[model samples]
Target: MIVGTAGHIDHGKTALLEALTGQAGDQRREERERGMTIDLGYRYAALTPGAPLTGFIDVPGHERFIHNMLAGAQGIDLVLLVVAADDGVMPQTREHLAIVELLGIARALVVISKCDRVEPQRVQEVQTQVSVLLAAGPYAGAAPFMVSSVTGEGIEPLRRALLAAQSEVSQRSREGGFRLAIDRAFAVAGAGIVVTGTALDGRVQLGDTLLLGKAGKPVRVRGLHAQNQPATEAHAGQRVALNISAERLQLEQVHRGDWLLAEWLHAPTQRLDIELQLLASELRAFEHFSPVHVHLGTQDVTARVALLQGEQLLPGARMFAQLLTNAPLQAVHGDRLVLRDQRAQRTLGGGRVLDPFAPARQRRSEARLAQLQALASADSLEQALPALLACDDGGLDPQRLERQFNRLRSSWQLPANAQVIATRQGPLLFTREHWQALQNSVLEGLARFHTQEPDQLGPDRDRLRRFVALALERPAFISLVDELLAANRMSSSGPWLHLPEHRIRLSDADALLWSQLQPLLVDGAFDPPWVRDLAKALSVDEAEVRVLLRKLGRLGQVHQVVRDLFYPEATIRQMAAMLLQLASDDPVVQVAAFRDVLGIGRKRSVQILEYFDRIGLTRRVGDRRQIRADNALAQSPGQ
Candidate 1:
């Protein structure tokens, strides 16, 4: 079970956790002298005697470092809210309670610490104040106790209360994808760079390559330790210390905001969607589009809020809003957040993240606002997937999708042809239908180009690339085109592409000229005849003969042997089949015999044989031709 300590500054939070766990939480020298925590500190406790697995997260109580406190509170199972008996329910105490409430922490035991400093009557008065405060927050009706780490007055009762809380806590499983928010980074003498944090989900072993967010750099785990002892693997709900093998990383290079992830997750974005609520005690004069400090998962960003409902919100009222940040942040859906007013620098309220990577939208658009609200309320992946798909404008990045649905990816059951492709700009999600439509459009574009330019073989690759890029305007356009070719819907020759289903239909005059050109192709030469010669021989116009040659080239029915000469499809196919069959029987056939067998001169035979090699029909030995073992002719037709 995992436990968390929460209270205002200098309220004996770290002291109580230390006394209960036998571990000192304050690592920095300043925190020990100042008597206030400035950063998050972690320690472990064993509620059950000789138990193997039990821990607690000791969080800072300072209002300024509440962002650090939030990072520690994300994966906690039980709360040990330490309230001093002398000063009950202070400002930071109320803010921390609001954060826990927004984060959905249900079970808690309120500890009124430092009871020895106050008189008995004063302690009772503080208890009454604490009870009133708890009645209105998430800790309403929770059990309250008094404890003092100095005198050990109520330690036994507090221990019993913690043990009872441990019994009611459930175990956390490590079945999802790994996500470790790095709160501390340092270097060990012998071991390389080391990072310590609590694993949010899934497990990490001693040797696993992990991708850090935004940077996307791969780092290997050299070792793992849990509770100061070497361990093979660390799972969710366990505080972990990892020794990384990256030598170039400095201690200051990695900060409290980076994430160590299992797979490449989403790129950090500057805008987000959230369901915000204002605290009842906050002033109602705060406007709707006010600037505030946004805190989530150890990241603090400055953002302006735009309310989804009325012009201004009343205290204790909930409303949907968008946060436009000043910088990028690494966040995910369902993460809790705290918003503090910028002018006064006081925490206004808190809320849960709905869309951590949303795009900016204009205000006063009712339809889009309603859509965002629906996305926030979606309870399952089935509901969320379709809503995300509808909002995706065809250019959602694959890495972002993997992170957002890492836990539910297996359940999505995307088809084989469906793919998430990444390009230089971003990622795009495509299904079989989208690929088919793209192929059809490319084929039609090629056909149009062939009709207009009779001299060219086909549309060049640049033309096709540009056409698709302009038509789709998606970041994954190049990747999608590559997928289309891999699936055999399109084929490439030289620098041109052709759709497998597109064929060139010929007119009567062109058919006549094609018949005349077929016999002359047997005698391949650099310059055969001009268009006028072909027209004079076939009794047709020169323009018609030119059109015939162009049509044949586009359909792969003919290839330009030289500047003016052309070879017909029938001659090429017959020679290709003979060469394939001969190479299959004799592993080594001389180049001279290959030329003689095809009934063509050396030049044309070499070109046709090289083409066969490229099509995977044959292999080239030392100055000879040999058939590939896995060639199409080597397999039976049924295959």
Candidate 2:
């Protein structure tokens, strides 16, 4: 268990830590000379013999160094809120208490220091003041311990209470990838570089490779110490110092607020959707787009709050908002954050991160708001997923879903109503209702199109996508189409997509004209005649021949290689087979070779190859084309 000290400056916080640990707390030269802690100080000791070590973080109580105090406050199990009996409930004391409350640190032990210097009545007065302060916060029932650091009065009892509280400190869940917020970094003799911080989640073993900072520079852990004791590995909720090394890493490149993370947990973002509360202490309302200092983990960055609910947030009220930071911040769901004024002078309030990957636009939409509300009310992804999927129509990316929740795929408690559809991008998660609705929408859409235009077969994939009138990603929609085709619920011919039951046939007059046209197209199968030439040979109007051929093209009876040019569907299939044979020798099918195989002119070969490219049969790269393995034509001519 880690305990942090919080109080006004010169309240003997560091001195109290020294008394408890039997070790000097103010080890810095400046701190010893000034008789105050200028920065965060640390001490570790087993309060009772054979008991687990209890780490102590003695934070500077000066208002100017509140940022330093906040750095040490994160990941602590309990807080020792020290109040000097001689100066009861000072300004920094109140601010520190408010910070602890905002940080959601529920366990606190109030300590009234310098009791020997004050009379019993004065000590009682300080306790009453502390009680009133705790009454409105999470530490309401915490009893105060009176002690004089100089005399060691009541010291033994305070140590006993700390041991008792340590038993009640629940262990942090070790379900996420390892992450440590770096607060101090330096070089040690014979060691390349070392970084110390509280391990926020997961575990790290000796020789484990971890990514460092937002740049994700890879580093190997050479050694580690957990809770100030050398160990082979360290897990969450322990103060740890890692001896890390990389080829390019230097002490200058690392600083406070940088993170040591597992490879899968290295995503850093500039925007965070959060549930914020305005402190009742604020005299004025917090306006939209208000600039403030955002403190999460051990990092402090300047950010502007974009209010999601209203133009202004009243003091003492809670609201959801998005924070747009000037620099990237590494955060995950449920991570606590504090907001100070833009000047970084005073604590305004704090909040919990709801979504680290916040959308830049439409964040105020009803659907988005509902999703945020769901995320706010739930503690885990499993609890919030039902409402989230209900509001999100596009379905969730399984990769992002797992990453957002900081859990591995094996640990996810996926809902039974959820469906996973495989796409080239990754697996997409959709509620069964939403998935069925998408499939039905496609079928119903094709049926409606057939009814409206009985002469036309159906729209192509791109046109069908637009016709559906729903916002689905292209990859996911392609996956949906493939699934339907595999299930025999929908079918595609050439470039057109339609329901299996929908079909278009040539009218009798057009059919008769098509019969006369088929002979001309098949006679020179490799180099079909243009519509104007066919019409001239048949002694018919060029416009009529063009209309008849276009109708045939729609019914998959003919291929329109180019404007006014048509080929018999069988001839096109034969040409595709020839190209595939050429591609077998070398995947790159050049135009010269294709033209030679078809015994056609250069222009005719280029046109036919371009048509093949258009239908996803082949992809053209420069002057050569590569056959697409997934193309049905490549698999077999009958397809």
The prediction achieving the highest lDDT against the true structure is 2
**Candidate 1: worst-modelled 10 consecutive residues by lDDT:** 630-639
Candidate 1 lDDT over residue span 13-113, tens digit each = 88888778777865689887877887777776676687655677788888777777887887677888889988877888887887777777878888889
lDDT of each: 0.70, 0.90
User: Can you write out model 2's per-residue Cα lDDT over 1-639, one digit (the tens) per residue?
Assistant: 999999999999988998999998647888788887878888899999999999999999999999999999998999999999999999999999999889999799999999999999999999999999988878887889999999999899999999999999999988889989998998999987999999999999999999999999999999999999999999999999999999978899999999999998889999999999999999999999999999999999999999999999999999999999999999988999999999999899999999999999889999899999999999998998888888888888867766677877888888889988887678888999999999999889888888887888777776788888776887788788888989999887765777787777777988788888889889977877888899999999999999988888887778888899898878878888888889889989899999999887898889999999987788999999999765557657644
Candidate RMSDs in Å, in order, are: 9.5, 3.3
The regions of model 2 sitting more than 4 angstroms off are: 519-528, 558-562, 566-638
User: Which residue runs of candidate 1 sit more than 4 Å off their true CA positions?
Assistant: 285-289, 306-314, 360-371, 379-383, 386-400, 411-639
State the number of backbone clashes in model 2: 0
Residue 116 displacement in candidate 1 (angstroms): 2.8
